[model samples]
Target: MKRTTGQLAVVIAALVAGSATAQDMSKIVNTPHNMANLDVWGVVIPENQVCLPCHTPHNARAVEDGASQILWNHALTEQTFEMYTTAAGHQGGQPEGTSKLCLSCHDGATAIDDFGGNEDTFDNVMIPADRLSNMGTDLRDDHPIGIEYPPPDLTGYNDKSTFTGVKVVTINGVDRVECASCHTAHDNSYGKFLRQTMEGSALCVECHDK
Candidate 1:
């Protein structure tokens, strides 16, 4: 019997839960070897409500561009970035997924003090203009996103078909790359939510035309 991806997720979650408790300050104040751990712009978020900088349990709300199923407690920034693509071979399109989440703080466009619970309006919130440093809106030199990985013919990849986990994601009749497709939200041996181990260009070739 073949186990589905959903089944695998359940198993991974169960394993993670058994070893860890609710995300607390002590867990986040330290290093970020795991997802439950927190690292704000490479700096450890201090204990207190600061941990609420991103994750929250009660009133978490999703951002405008992300999946509505998940709750987001942070106020997402509006800045854009250069994404990765094959045209430049090094550039990318619009930033998405965890990268977007990372930029919410790293971009410096939004105030760190402004959280989901804050009553301060967007304009009222003051983020330092000089401190703000971002990749910017043109994503040609970053990494490519929002592209479908599946081919019209699946058999061409031969035995590598199982590894080709790409799926179609259509938004308003247009398609975009979803974070979950390449990055497993649950337990993974690889860093940065990657779906598989990284040895040379293994992860990139998994979906690209190469």
Candidate 2:
């Protein structure tokens, strides 16, 4: 029987929790069941790798600017991006939430094998550097980040009718709803840790309509 996404998340989380050491993470990746699932996200991480990619064994760094979540070895990507929206909701900057972690590899600027706090120059890494011209510094073509979900002006909006609740996440004393709020880094019931699955235009409408 095919396991539900929730079930799979539970299993993956349990595996990570049980193994506290980085070297032991290989067991979770090598598990026959999870190997297939990891492929779904296009995660090409190899077995026998350290757990720091997603989890940490000791003194894991913070994920956000001020928050204290267990961050792995990879230096978070610091690129600004443009989000999709017809309204002028996002005004300040790009979203950094979990996307920072995603971009550490997907941005095509950093090496996949690069890790630890050595801060060595890119020339030293064995993995070849990515040379994709399309992966430019300007992220207008990519998804946007660092935007507020609910604007201050919701006079015409009905929260109840929209099937939504107010989320109070404050970063640097400023109220904002970022990509990480709706996503998870460890394990999630939905693909890519999205709060909900986006089918057709439904996903876009969930946050855009309001």
Candidate 3:
């Protein structure tokens, strides 16, 4: 079959996008070379089961709170976090969606090895208390999640038109900001595992008006 110029261009664009995605996936930190017995924390499991700690094909949908369909191999966090708030406009709520998945390890509540519905046999790996990555349950000091951005209105959030520019990922059909918005859970091409560079506050400027 002969293809039109537009169709050829679309195919080329898709190939390029796929190549970029594959490249980024290769650079992610979840590889066996990076996570397999690396000198990270004493609590980490020494096994070479890299992605097994967080994902699985079957039985992932067996878990609760709509976690199974996402291939969530890890256990959900049981702790309730102290959520974020602004002095004037506060809309944050309890952790949900991907943010909850991140807290599965980062909140310092759940064990890293406690996944695949088998925490007993797994090594007693956990993010340490001293590490900055251990965000704990209290989030009043951290950037906000589980909240809606200011709506397009006149009196309340009308002044902050630039908020629309901040990156966001939709979950359950609602445009919400989750931890994955700013950070990559698996990718670390950015030195700090951030999704983008922070030089000159470029990442911050993506959402903030200033």
lDDT of 1 by residue, 1-210 (tens): 899999999999998886555434133333242322423333323354535656677778666555333566666668766555553242324555554665565465655545655535423333345542343455454345555444333323222345554343444454455555555444344655466656776776666546
**What is the lDDT of every predicted structure here?**
0.51, 0.50, 0.68
Candidate 3 local lDDT, residue 105: 85
C-alpha displacement of 161 in model 2, angstroms?
11
Sort the predicted structures by lDDT, highest score first: 3, 1, 2
Q: What would the TM-score be for candidate 2 when compared with the true structure?
A: 0.53
Give the alpha carbon lDDT tens digit for every residue of 1-210 in model 3: 999999999999999999767767436444322445555654353365677767877877344445225787888888988987766566567787778888888888687778785667866676879989789999998988875644333134323334432356565666666787787666666556676678887667666546
Worst 10 residues of 3 by lDDT: 151-160
Clashing pairs in 3: 43-125, 60-68, 61-68
Compute the lDDT of residue 170 as modeled in candidate 3. 63
Q: Which candidate is the best by TM-score?
A: 3
lDDT string for model 2 (162-194, tens) is 533223245666555554545544343344445
Per-prediction CA RMSD (Å): 11.5, 9.7, 10.0
Candidate 1 TM-score, true structure as reference: 0.50
Evaluate model 3: give its lDDT.
0.68
